[model samples]
Target: AIFSVGVSQLNASLAHRIPAREENILPTFRKALDLAREDADRLCHWISQDVSEDDFINWVTGSVRRMWGKKGNREVQAQFESDEGRRSVFDMLINLAGYSMKTKDILKQCDRVVEGAVLMRSLLKKVSHN
Candidate 1:
């Protein structure tokens, strides 16, 4: 009983030292989406003729590239660091695309990412306790 109590106390001390994970991805994602929408609108305005499929593709590519930049990547990394954040990421990925092979693949990958993050967090907690 004394040993277990000491172990628990140690674990508690270590856990307190570890900082809580942040949830910044959702807000960044929302901001990125809004910026993408605005950029797409601007691109549409610049066209003299009827917008074509190519134009739409360009807009999408540009917007995604902008959003997936350094800061956006950091935000995503922050989200993937936490269990709840992973769920938020998974939901965001699901809502971004419709029922398609790409969406399915991303969803599968997201599940793995979430599971991996949870496992890693647990391992960290255990290691800290030890």
Candidate 2:
């Protein structure tokens, strides 16, 4: 219940904070944002369970990789027009990185990377607004 609420809060926060850089891009951005929230919820559920460390690591790796694979020159050209759009994608990745991992060292490193992304997203938001 708490986790669900947290996920909802994050979804609301991200949706509210991350604006589409262009007028025509808002709807597509919302769709992608929703998908990212759903993925985070799913990842949180896995964390709540008594899954093995290996399984948790594997799942997170695969999930992040899938996200990475979806991003590229072609998709970026087609889907995003500004750096804010790119920041939105990383926001989703950061949401995933908030998951609790059985193995601390590896996930800690991953979290560090996500933290950088989160910071970049914030910086980009500031720049976009200005």
Candidate 3:
């Protein structure tokens, strides 16, 4: 719940900082932002359910892959693969960790979460920059 709220706040901040001129943004970047918002909502929904660790890990991995697919070009893909991108994704997981003490099962999949975060960071960076 806390993690989802943080994600929402981050996304809102990004949306607000970007120019209102939609024409200046890449079509794929816009789609990535939309997908990210949807994912945050889904994460909230999932948190309320009695989901297994495996299921949660799958969702994390799949969502990251979906976001990566939204990369518009080589430049965007490269950005996703950059150090900043990796850091952002890991930071999200760190935030999640703070809220997971009550649900220790989720923490059991830390390795998987880290894998997904590596890919997710790129999508986050791409969306943030453009």
Best by lDDT: 3
**Model 1 score (lDDT):** 0.40
TM-score of each: 0.21, 0.23, 0.22
**Tens-digit per-residue lDDT, 4-34, candidate 3:** 3444545565587576465544553565567
Q: What are the Cα lDDT values of the candidates?
A: 0.40, 0.44, 0.46
Model 1 bad stretches (over 4 Å): 1-22, 49-130
- The best-first sequence of candidates by TM-score reads 2, 3, 1
Angstrom error of the Cα, residue 29, model 1: value is 0.5
Query: Candidate 3 at residue 53, lDDT?
Result: 35
Residue 12, candidate 2: Cα error in Å is 24
- Model 3 residue 102 CA deviation (Å) reads 13
Which prediction has more favorable TM-score, 1 or 2?
2
Can you write out model 1's per-residue Cα lDDT over 1-130, one digit (the tens) per residue? Answer: 1122333444454465455334544444455566566666754443322323343234224432344445433443343345332132233343233212223477765754564444334333333343
